[model samples]
Target chain A: MSTRSLYVSADTPVHRLTARSKIGLATALSIAAFVFTTPIAVGIVLAVAFGALAWAGGLRNLRRVWFIVVALFVVGFVVWPAFTPARGPTVLATPLGSLSSYELRFALGRSFRIVSFIIIGLAFVSATSNEGIVRGLRSIGLPYAFCFAVGTALRLFPTFLSAADTVRQAQEARGLDLSAGNPIERVRGYVPLLVPVFVNAVRQVNDQSMALEARGFDTRGERTFHGKRPLAGRDWIALALATLIVVGTLVGRYGFGVGAL
Target chain B: MREVFTMWRDTRMILLVAVVAAVYAAILLPFKVFTILPGLTSVRPANAFPVVFGLMFGPAAAWGSAIGNLIADIFGGTFGPGSLGGFVGNFFFGFVGYKLWGNLGPLSSGEEPNMRSIRQVVEYVLIAVASSAMCAVIIAWVADLLGLVPFSVLAPIIMVNNTLAAAVLGPPLLYLTYPRIKDIGFLYPELLADEELSAAGASRRYVAAYGLLVVSLVWLGVGLLVGTGAAPGTLTVGLVGLVGFVLVLAFAIIGAERLSAILERAGARPAGRNR
Candidate 1:
């Protein structure tokens, strides 16, 4: 019955910020990460992202994605240098060509930029609940139906996953050999697993639609929500700080060339 | 495309959207550990869901697949700025197949969607390839623009991954479920028949849209090759790719709007049952 999500329950300020504000802050940090081209600037953003995740007690979840993070870092570091033009003094020689200091530095900056993106993404999801995501998006003027669908999907994700597992087990019990086939046949083995789940889903849709109509789901009017709260003063402060960081980074990069490679 | 927006008004369509999303994410989540490219994409048998569901559920599948992909990314630990591309890319992965099936194939004269006939099967494969390419170009272009992954590398990989899954799993799934869904009164065309009434008269426009889609895809493919193949940082190459990207968006939006006009006209007709 357990659902998969990245949200970590905590009482820290990072988690306490309204979902909308957190979304805004995460967006701002992401934009700044892309704008800054220097290793130093990108490193600062990465540090801030990591620090924020730690503050929210969401760092524990990093274990799940450590492989991806490490792989991205390694790929960025290696690939960018290979493509980059050799410039400045020679740092190393290879069969292909000599590596320059500038190429090495560019590689370092790109690696940090890529890693920063994942950190910011993890931080945002770790602090915001699925319901909060829907509410926040709704408050920002998305259509109610779309938001409802998104929230419903999040809730149903776990149910369906569990159902797929059950269907697979049942099929196995009935002597379905999923592993004893060519690649294409192995994929075809998914037919039984997929069909039953989809059929059950269609049946649920019919009943669910009836329930929705009975609850006046199609009615037009202002609707009230549970757990709705006004944006607090602390939310404003968080938003302002995020704005400042983004604006400052852009100004430093474009106006003064402080973060350029 | 018009139904993509109008379906929001129907409670059942909204519910279908949720169901599709849940099913897609459920199928996609287990494969998260098998990363073909970390933080970009993974080995995806679930890629077939979008095509089969799109053919069955229409616009609901488009929106649902988009949301489902986003959910997979969030839980799979791959959510990032590139997720914007993934959302749009997955939307079209579902959208293009449904939109093109009856408009461009042997079924273009308004035959019901099926996989029994050889011509119908060929048409299904073409639809799968076109949709897969559309998804790959959009995602790889965005990833390249963000400097995350090169188009030359990611585009071909995604195209093959998606097309293979769709070609392998799509027809059988459709054959199994299409008749049952139609019987249950949940088949998208029947369920939304009122809104899609003008579909008969709009075939030419649909063909035109498909043409523009093909042109844009070609433009993007050529531009990406030229941009990345020559001097890596050439200004003209960048401009070529940028222009190509803009044309793809422009043509896609224009085509959707044209189809939406058809729906608007259909809605203006007298409220009566034709079925």
Candidate 2:
């Protein structure tokens, strides 16, 4: 399995930003990407997202998500025209019957929107660690219980992956060729692999519950956490800029309908 | 609300949630990476999670499924603002599955399913189908509103994917795991509710099923009207209408049976006492 984190721990401006600010900015940019439906507006957002990724020294992470983006582009290319309710004058192609220029434009705009969303999202993940996410969520008024639960969940992800790997290996040793069979047979083959993992996982749960009880982990009160980075002025400025981009696009799209197809 | 908080307060329960979430994400991320439409949708074996986890872990499983989806999104490189919709929608998958399963019939005391009993098996299937439909409706509706994808395209795909995964993998796992965990002394969510609350819960599920029955019937009616009134080439609309009609009838019939079963059990008990 691939790793859970793509964080680079760089010292660039984007990495130095507080996790809360980065998360907020990612959310704002993603909303803007979804709201706007024009090529130019989405193209600009994509440019800004790429710029941030470069600043964070996390452009390397783009390699991981390229296939997904290409898939999105391809699927949208086919589906948008076939299902689009509108008919246009300009015919773009006759492959699989006639296609319209208008549908192609629609697909391009949608693809740009998707690309911008992924770029900003990956940039945020590349810059922030899991611990940083807990702190960020806690600082933003989320309950400590929620933060702890999510933090523990993030920490344990790799452990489960390792356990699954062990199970798969053991099954392979016993002649389970998951890839060699037809689709239905492969799906059936996964049962032996999964049942053992799930049963072992339940067994592990018993040990976990006991360990937690020994730690007195249920005591409820105000708790203290160390090593949380305070949001500085630059974080605020970054958030403000994100807000402006989002608001500007919303106005352009809805107030004047400038970005409508 | 109190049960939700209580589950959170228990450290062991919290640990269970974490472990379940981690396992779920580990299973989910691989499928998520190679997507039909990366950010919008995918063919997910990950869909099997809510039913299995919910049956095993209860409310914590709901929270775990939601958080796990977010983690999987990040790992799969599909994380975005749209994740908010995913969070809420995925939560319902577990919530509804566990709630409906525990209330509908006796299912071997939360340890293992009594697979020989056809009623229990039907209950499991009903929960899986209903949960998949609920998750699909909420997530796809939000995606449509966000302009992520058209509702017509997204909902059916998600519903089919989730249902297929759960139907294929859910029952045998339930049968296998129940015998091992039944004696573990941990508090299962089915044991959390009193008899009165469970009966009330069953009634509420019936109400939800009836509501879905009405909405789906209306959808079929509208589709038929448009199909007949419009040009002869609109055969697709008519077919879609027929499919909608069939799906809703299945839901209604199963739901009514469950309700009747609950009532019979209640009536068989001593007077003025909760089952």
Per-residue lDDT of model 2, residues B1-275, tens digit only: 23445566666667777877888887776543124445446555557778877766667778888888888877777777667768877886776664555344343122234344666677677778777876766665565556555456666777777777777667776776655655563425332333322233456555545444344434533443443344355445435544653554355333321222332353522333332
Clashes counted in candidate 2 amount to 2
**lDDT accuracy of residue B15 in candidate 1:** 90
Please tell me which predicted candidate would have the highest lDDT against the true structure.
Answer: 1
Please, what are the lDDT tens digits per residue for candidate 1 over residues A105-222? 8888888988898899889888888998888789788888889999999999989999988998999999987666666777777788889998898789989989988877772466
- C-alpha DockQ for predicted model 1: 0.58
lDDT of 2 by residue, A79-110 (tens): 56655654677665555577666776777777
TM-score of 1: 0.90
Q: What's the true lDDT of residue A226 in model 2?
A: 70
- Evaluated against the true structure, the overall lDDT of model 1 is 0.77
Q: Chain B TM-score, candidate 1?
A: 0.81
